[model samples]
Target: MRQQNHKNTFLKTIPFTSIFVEALKQSSMWVSSNYIDGNSQFQGKLLLKVDSQWESVQLNLHPEKLYRKGVGSDDYTSYCQLQACFLKKFTHFDPTMPNYRYGIRLQFGQQLSHLLCENSDVFKKWFQFLRRFCIMDKFARKYKVLGKIKQCDPVFGQCLFSCVRVQDAEYHVVKVIDKNVITAGQKQNLYRELSNLRKLSQTQICYIVEVFEDEQSVYILYEYYLGIDLRTYIKESQIYQMAEQSSQGLDEKLVADILYGVLQAIQHMHSKGVFHRDIKMENLFIPEKKRLPFVVLGNFCYSETTDSTQYKKCGTPGFVAPEIFRSKNYTSKVDLFSLGIIFYLLVYGKLPFEGKDQEEILRSNEKCDIDFKFEKKICKKISISGMDLLKGLLNKEPIKRLSAAQALNHHWFIKMGTRNQRNQYLQVQRGKSLSTIIENSVDITQSYYQSNSQLYQSTKEDDKLDRVEKEFIKGSLYDKLLYFNSIQYQPSKIRRIQQST
Candidate 1:
């Protein structure tokens, strides 16, 4: 009796037709009859209401048939705020719409229908009420699983851990995309990434182990990596300690090995016609335990196939290529440019082109004035051949840049030491521990020279010295001069230099 009274109260609050309410009760499917199709311009469909000319359409709101629903824009930029408000009101409703005009897209199998209501307020109420009947009850019956929320961020949404019974055994590490707020474009991108991951056969790349989805969320089980991202690894390794003390940057051989692994993974992706537009240190993961040169590449949200021709600007600021800024169509070379930036960071412990802000960074990228010389001062141990490879990878002209295949064949990679040599270098790098040096000296001239030397080495390296001499020059002039002075001005070395000149 109390349940019937509650039902009556719900029916009174929602101004919907009895036939619609009966249909919902019968099928356990939700339909919002409160929304009167405001557009009189919609042709071909017969008007359901002669009194108001408001058209009504039958929609099957099943979990398997419904792809996604959103208002105003597919990207959900227009109705995001409105959707958020609706989500707050109706906790079960996963609002994927952008806050703009009142337009809703209902996709059922291959058929798609667009419904435009009067305003945002009406649309919000419509979606909020719809959630009551549109709950994933059928989905709950299909998959019996237990899970817990792992991480939740506003932008990326929640990362949940679930265990599924497969062949009488449980599989863990399943990613659950629950009622967390996310855009429709992001939802589509998730599906696209999953599809692409399924197509890939490479073991080096991160791939989905299993996939399961209900009406409310998506569950993706991916192969796990027991390590930190490259960005954090670089910080923890203290590769920049060389700036203050007599330490060294990352070894050239180790850098080569890492790049080699990255290139192989990229080669596999390219062969599959997929390009990872956003390649950065944050996306690359290195194992905590010694895995030699192997590094896992994750985050395929910004990746695209080679055949895709749309030229919208996307990617992180410093790593974004010049062509993307110019709004010109680009190819897989964009990934190469981004890879070059990562490679430069690995070698120099800093970006090749940097600015105070995003705009400045983009401007620097546009100019493409890479500072190869600065690398010499900070990283004195790097080989000339390595610098040449950096130049090839970082070339502004996409056509001129070395392809992944060509990069693999470069002299630097060709001369790369054996796996044992790389392992030994990694061990040495791990062993060297340096305390963080703070600049406490007040001497103006001494501090000025030190700061200028670091800056001048970074910004004016190419302008001050010729590339040919830079390649041959071993260590710094200070070290060479100290050796010469210790030898009491060796005439034989001076004669050899004069002969060479």
Candidate 2:
């Protein structure tokens, strides 16, 4: 009788042990739960299972009313939270209970429900697990509607881009902006961008493809381009030319073509009363497989309409115009100044004015101290017209700077060689190695930094002396007399005092 009783006890314990083991495995997979359904007044267990093609959740309790079947986990939105004090009061209030009450909130379109759990640890783990699935589900549903997210593109601010398919045959780029990070100011800027993009009609400019929003984020779809930005392309080309012992850095014709395209785009924007306040090489995209002289201008976050005159100081550090620094009203010529910088970069593969830091660089811009003589040394084959155009664009006075139309009609673009001539000029011959070119460029930059440093120090000393003189002039008569007396009697008085001591 004792042996039979022991056998019965052991057999009863086996089921509980198996259930615990199963729960542990489910938790490891990040989906274990029991919840009370207030609407049905029925308790149920929720289990999520993912396979090669489907992600489904099974609710153990049968309901009197069936809402829908074959619904994927992605269809429901999930949120986890601790039970509020009021909720506990309304429900089962257990003051002696050690564990906290938690719940998973679910939303399917307009429908809402909550799954109540008793354990805090389980709530946290389940919440995290469910939230990830929610995001995954969101993306999966988007794939069905907007095609699949193929790959990630360059990320800017709180926005990211992915290569996405729109139709079965068409691929485009989609910008994802998290609504959680959108501030009031940023929202205004986004509105401006949308307005500006809508007003643009130029083929050279990149326009918005589509705009949509979900609960958590906004999506701005863009037409995809099969190329890198001008900055990356130029840097890569320089590296390649250096490695290949090419006599030329880049084809001047190609450079002219890129400039022409950018100028046209700017002209188009300007014609519409839109000013691209921030224009840099990074904003210009060129084709990866060059069939023609194609370029597209993008990134309109800083762009503004001309009707708004009260402008804040905004732009990339080196590319910003001098008037912007003075807090003065600036015109579209600011873009011209930036264009000049780009022109200089394309020609010489270096910035006209650089410093150890941004402050010094701004000071250099204020002084309009640029080295135009370096062009001949850098590119001996470049024509006088090219240099002249560069000078016109880079002119310090915005009023005197060349407009986009003027630059387009400039002799440099008109007289630039044919494709064959450009190819001939770009042909590789005996030249400096990649290492040698980079070293030379570095040496020049370092020398410029050293010179700027010395000049800065001298200017600082002069300012110090000027300050001393101004202070002396502003001093009271008694203070002035005391200063002079100290200067006159300091050495002799010190000797006499020492002797007395």
Clash totals in order? 10, 0
- Model 1 residue 31 CA deviation in Å: 30
Whole-model lDDT values for every prediction = 0.53, 0.53
Question: Which residue ranges in model 2 land beyond 4 Å of their true spot?
Answer: 1-158, 239-249, 288-292, 375-378, 417-501
Q: Which pairs of residues have clashing backbones in candidate 2?
A: none
Models 1 onward score TM values of 0.54, 0.52
Worst 10 residues of 1 by lDDT: 79-88
Root-mean-square deviation of Cα positions for candidate 1 versus the true structure, in angstroms:
19.8
Q: Per-residue lDDT of 343-426 in model 2, one digit per residue for the tens?
A: 887776677778899888877876777776553333434554465567677777777677877666553554464333222322
Tell me the tens digit of each residue's lDDT in model 1 across 1-501.
654654343223211222112222332222223222221111211111223343543332221122122223232111110100111111111134232235444222222234444455756655543332222122244344566644332236556454555454544455666634655666656645654564455656876554443445555666655366778766776656744365554566777888878887888888777888888888887755646467888777677777677756888888988888776588888888898898888766678778899888888887888867564444546655566667667777787676887666443554465344323433333422111000111111234335323322333434443454343233344443444345423445444544565
